[model samples]
Target: MTDPQIERKLIEIMRIINESDRPVGARIIADELRNRGYNLGERAVRYHLRILDERGFTEKHGYTGRSITLKGKEELEEALIGDRLDFVITRIEDLIYRTDYDPVKKQGNVIVNVSYVDKDDFEKTAGLMRSAIDYSISPRVGIFEEDSEDIFVPTGKVGIATVCSITFDGILLRHGIPVKPNFGGILSVENNEPVVFKDLISYRGTSIDPIKIFLMRQSTSVTGLLQSGFGTILANMRSIPQSAVENASLLFQQLHESDIGGLLAMDNESGNVLGAPVDVGMSGIVVSVGVNALAVVEEYGIDVTTRPVSTIMDYGTMKPL
Candidate 1:
């Protein structure tokens, strides 16, 4: 097998190339890595670049710069999955075993976000979500569609689903919220609504290996949303008012500076940006794990001082997604 050190560097190289609008050179990428605490130089970076090119994860432009290929993006995402495995796995445990679940008054939820390049990929992901949801045996789950009001979603686009876990479906860590019972959904303001994974799936579909999904909500007990799922995690910023959410520089900055290693920081492209400054108004509805949640709350000045869970809605006959 390739040296683990070199393999990591290769992933970082692809990350830089994927985030850059312009072609990137090894020296530029190497320097970037050094700033992030990776110890390497241009020569070493270039040596690996050639290997990546040979592996078809990237392409070279002689003196111009390097660019990532479709394969490269997939590899990067897969690597990210590895990086988040511990956090995800841990949260999954926390949700299932660490918390109390009441069927009559279920108030937990998990939001699933999926990124796809084509119709075929979209369908497979949707089917996977369906299978995962069924697997979870969540009592109630609402797959959010495009909001009729233009304010919540684009006029013409695939509506995203905000799968709510009202019944302690799973456990997740909200970055800025306290580590108690809490609620909030993190989503993009511009995008407004989730991109529904199922609708985009044309009937001629295949299957995808299961992926862990998580969600957070602002209210401690979201009356109707319910859940049941595979290994997953969640985070929420419910206390941050709608006003402060607009100027999320510090919220995202705090996230970047946070030591908790929550959700992956998003990059400038589509879907998730793990370990970078998340976009402003990138909203999520997550319940706090109560551990790392306080660090963000104090820094951002959110007022969810206590877990305000009360008034469980009578969950009567809600269909599952």
Candidate 2:
């Protein structure tokens, strides 16, 4: 097995190349590494690159630069699984780093927004964000507009909203506003592009009981969630606080073991609640890239019309009814 240090650097190199539109040089990688706080220089990066090349993780293209190989891609994907878990835990720890913070009362979560010019990269970014978050912090996705009135660049952008409690419909069950499960109902909204509105609103709809399975709502085509420019966020539906998660240590331990599915409900087996977020509101993930959205007009299948990730402006933090 590769040493931990080399393994981390290799992952970064593969990610950099993957994120780039074309092949890149060691100098480019080195510059980025410096920007990202890595103390390595170009020569060191080149040395590592040679090693990776010898290992068949990268392919050299004459004088242009080296690109990652299939082996490199698979390696990065496998490494990402572990990184995603660490990222989520670190995110939660960052937010709740207060003295008087309560792990109960309000639900807290993480919001991650990343936009890409390339469609495939966009979907991959969304998947990474979702996988990193959904196991712990309940994420809600959308296109977000910053709380400002003087910027067109930042306005009407769909982004991801990862939160602790199920806002609007799901959590409102406790407030006595019963949100029924949307078994087969497709809500239509005029004059809006793809953003997370009715999907979250309806999916958040749960029966009065908090412990029951949320009648799953087919938000958009499962394809839409993984589309290029517009990505659907995988959110969690949790009413209970993380503190209430029984045997959470074991849950986190399980997280270290295998690929835990991205749902935020309590474990039926161990009955462990693997959440501790206390602040219930919207946290914004600011991403930039967007293309003109096409109107979705499907009556039968998922309506790709309102792209949730496209319309995720932080403005509309849907309140619990």
Candidate 3:
């Protein structure tokens, strides 16, 4: 006799029926149960099936067999709610899980920026950088379609510290040595191509340093706009006010003597840069870096405290010796 309190027999019966690709005979189910150490008899198995059918959990498909109905599958799923993630990664094992499309092909992509003096170092750094991106973005369970293009509108600065890992690889690999063009911030997107918010500042070789930039918004009312798409978020943030422009100038002036390693635009209130900064070559290059940085800040509904700065100096902008 099966232990009535454990409900083990009933669970086993459901498991077997659910596993079969087609309806299974009651005798087959009972035999499987007995083989698994449950001493349920044929009559007991049939009785359980009738009860399950009455509860809309299973349905008799023909005179001799029964199959799990949609309702039955739902009950099993409900009972297995804690295993949802496991089920998805194991059963479907697709890259992108979407309510509307194939999970495999549509899997979100990630972008990593690595800075190295030599090509060999860049390749090595890429592996570590890729791992960082995977660990940071993958475990956010249920987040799909993240690519370089997905614009994350931060509700607050609370999580910004956690996201800094995206830039750690480049910084650590270079022993804190600044890149030539410096790192042009890194952008990871979900479900689309990454949008270039600003033109990169470059001199000689390819961009070696990369910074990951994100937009911040306080208006919860704008959350829906961000969800519509990245372009919408970019457009909305780009519409910041002129008052922010004046603030950007003040911030830049204050940093004149500070190491000011890298500059980020900030809103007077929240102190967060809402858009990407244009690469300004260096201290006193052309005014475009600061100007473009301010423009980007205003465009993203943010005020700038200082103009953007790069560690590298473009020879083209330097005076003749």
Per-residue CA lDDT of model 1 for 24-133, tens digit only, reads: 98767865564333546678888888998998999988789988888988888887465443333233333333233222233323332211123323344344434333
Q: How close is every model to the real structure, measured as TM-score?
A: 0.29, 0.30, 0.24
What tens-digit string does per-residue lDDT give for candidate 3 at 1-321?
A: 445433434555778999999889887787555433344677889988887787787888777688888887877767644543332122111111111211223222211111112222323322332333222211111111112111211232110101111111122122322222222322222233333333332221321111212222221112222334232221111112333344334433443332111232323332223334323331111111112222232344443221111111111222111
Candidate 3 vs. true structure, TM-score: 0.24
Whole-structure CA lDDT of model 1: 0.37
RMSD (Å) per prediction: 20.1, 15.4, 22.8
User: Over 4 Å off in model 3, which ranges?
Assistant: 1-6, 80-321
Residue-level lDDT for 192 in candidate 1? 18
Please give the clash total of every predicted structure, in order: 50, 30, 28
Location of the lowest summed lDDT over 10 successive residues in candidate 2: 286-295
> For each candidate, what is the lDDT?
0.37, 0.37, 0.33
**Model 1 superposed RMSD (Cα):** 20.1
Q: Candidate 2 local accuracy as lDDT? A: 0.37
